[model samples]
Target: MTGIKAPSKRQLNNYLYDRRREKFGRAAIYLDELEKWIFDGTTIPDDENEVFVFSYHVIEAEEPSFRLALSTKKLLNIVCSTDILHIDATYKLIWQGFPVLVLGTTDKNRKFHPLYLGVSTNERQEDFQMILMALKKRFCLYLIT
Candidate 1:
């Protein structure tokens, strides 16, 4: 059996930062493409030099709800420093309630890929489980013991 190798503090932090950057870059590209499609009715070529307009429509749709839901999800910072990996909604609300999940990592100073899952609603067990499964699949032993 392969033993689990714990990354050093620096290594973990670097990994986390790299992962964060990659995710942000991908999201930016996706948003840019989406905007181009919306405005020009054509797909934009994926290039680093591409100057894509970023509009409030992208942020306004998701940011306020996330900030509001954060009050309820109350995801504690397990590691010293933390990062939010992804934020998403699971379903439409019956009432005024909506479910949101935040995935990320934590550590004292430099933690790498610590999984934090949060849900806006009270019944978040399934959401949490899904998050854990997704994390395990992506990070393998980096997440599991």
Candidate 2:
């Protein structure tokens, strides 16, 4: 081949799936272990509402079409909730180092886990707004039912 071979659709999907599992699966496992520690009294909290912030640094951009330059980086945060956990994924601006939220959710125990996560340089505002809106919608729904 003259250049790098493009992955077929199936291959691409498999790669993405594996990446997703590696990232989100580890997070889930950590949370489960933390929960156990809390129940077993291994971990102590100063307050009733113990909030833990876990972050992961994404080295590689999952999507290239987003026009993200080489300097771009991504970060994901997980926060504990009463019924479910809240996840927020965003891209850190290279210059200002401000997060541009790309995805946010209140996923059930294990459902709705991310399978393909990425950041886009184009339409960052729109992406951030969409995720915020989605998170609000989910939170409202959770409150109702």
User: Which 10-residue window of candidate 1 scores lowest in summed lDDT?
Assistant: 65-74
- 1-145 in candidate 1: lDDT tens per residue? 4898878999999898889988766323344554444465222224423322211122234543211111111222222233444444556632235454545553556554423434333344554454454444433312212
Per-residue alpha-carbon lDDT of model 2 for 54-136, expressed as tens digits?
A: 22222234542221111111112231233443434445433123343323344556555331132333455655454444344
lDDT of model 1 at residue 101? 52
* Runs with alpha carbons beyond 4 Å of true place in candidate 1: 1-97, 110-122, 140-145
Candidate 2 positional error at 59, Å: 41
Report the backbone clash tally of model 1: 5
For model 2 the TM-score comes to 0.24
lDDT of 2 at 5: 91
Q: How far is candidate 1 from the true structure (C-alpha RMSD, Å)?
A: 20.5
Score candidate 2 by lDDT. Answer: 0.37
lDDT of each: 0.39, 0.37
